[model samples]
Target chain A: DTAVSQTPKYLVTQMGNDKSIKCEQNLGHDTMYWYKQDSKKFLKIMFSYNNKELIINETVPNRFSPKSPDKAHLNLHINSLELGDSAVYFCASSRFRTSGNEQFFGPGTRLTVL
Target chain B: AQSVAQPEDQVNVAEGNPLTVKCTYSVSGNPYLFWYVQYPNRGLQFLLKYITGDNLVKGSYGFEAEFNKSQTSFHLKKPSALVSDSALYFCAVRAQNTGTASKLTFGTGTRLQVTL
Candidate 1:
């Protein structure tokens, strides 16, 4: 079974368009995270939610918002996507809020904005 | 602040030979280190992790990492590497002492290339 899964593996949209990437994990984890990989392939943490509490919110644009309805799901909703927002979006989950736990990641969703 | 470092942007190793991708980290206390592999257009895959145990930790794909506190490093190693092993590797660390250290900080990344 796929541990972590995301939909819309590829997305291509124009500027000013809004999109949402869905992420779900079956590992029964409590912490979920979203990472953005830029053109240079520098992956950075965008957001992390633990027990439905927003924990890590790195230096990201206000246009990007992460919504976690529950522990098993964390979805990213971008408002008015721009060219700079184009990148691969990854969703990951860990068993709990402990550094000792290994993270499980989804296949990733590639977003390309024109 | 907890930080991870990948000294080399890339590493080249001959197929059938051993390979090493260096990674160093800094934290306030005992570090929770990890090694993740990323293939083309794929999300990061957990290879191994060093919590608190033996210095040597074995992981998926026949990969192993040695955690050295003195060196502040957790370098990933593999014996008899294959061309398929060529991919981007990342080292991450979490500060065990930090109040909010559950989040992982990843390095820029180190691409490994296996030549025939």
Candidate 2:
């Protein structure tokens, strides 16, 4: 069974448009995260939610918002997609709030804002 | 302020040869280190981790890592690398700033190319 999964594996939209990507985890993990992988293959964390509560909010722009209706799901919404927003988005989950827990990741969503 | 660094951008090895991917970290308190692998067009897969046990930790796919506290390093290693072992490897550390459920700081990543 897939532990973590993301919807719309590929996204193609025009600039200034809005888009939303959904993520779900079946591992019953308490923590979920959103990451952005740039063209340089650098993966950076954007947001993290623990038990549906906002835990970590990185230096990301306000145009990007993450919503976690519950611990099992976290969704990312982009208000105004820009050319720079074209990258691969990854979702991850981990159990417990411990320090050394391993995170499970989902198949990334490739977003292309033309 | 926790961070990890992968000095090597790429490491090439021949099949049946041993391989090593170097990783160093900096953190306030004891670190929680991890190693993840990513194949082309796939998501990151957890390979191994170091919490607070034996310095040497074994992980999936015949991979292991040695946690050196004095050096603040957790390097991934394999006994016999296969061509299929070629992938991008990432090292991450859990930040201890918040004292709560902390966020992970990842390294730049090292690409492993195992040739036949």
Q: Indicate which candidate wins on TM-score.
A: 2
Query: Which residue segments of model 1 deviate by more than 4 Å?
Result: none
In candidate 1, position A45 carries an lDDT of 86
Q: Residues A63-84, candidate 1, lDDT per residue (tens digit)?
A: 9999999988999999998999
Tell how far residue A90 is off in model 2, in angstroms. 0.4
- Tell me the TM-score of model 2: 0.97
Model 2 misplacement above 4 A: B96-98
Docking class of 1: medium
lDDT string for model 2 (B51-105, tens) is 8889999999999999999999999999999999999999999854366765788
Candidate 2 local lDDT, residue A103: 86
Error of 1 at B43 (Å): 1.3
Q: What share of the true interface contacts does candidate 2 keep?
A: 0.67
Best by lDDT: 2
Q: B24 in model 2: Cα distance from truth in Å?
A: 0.6
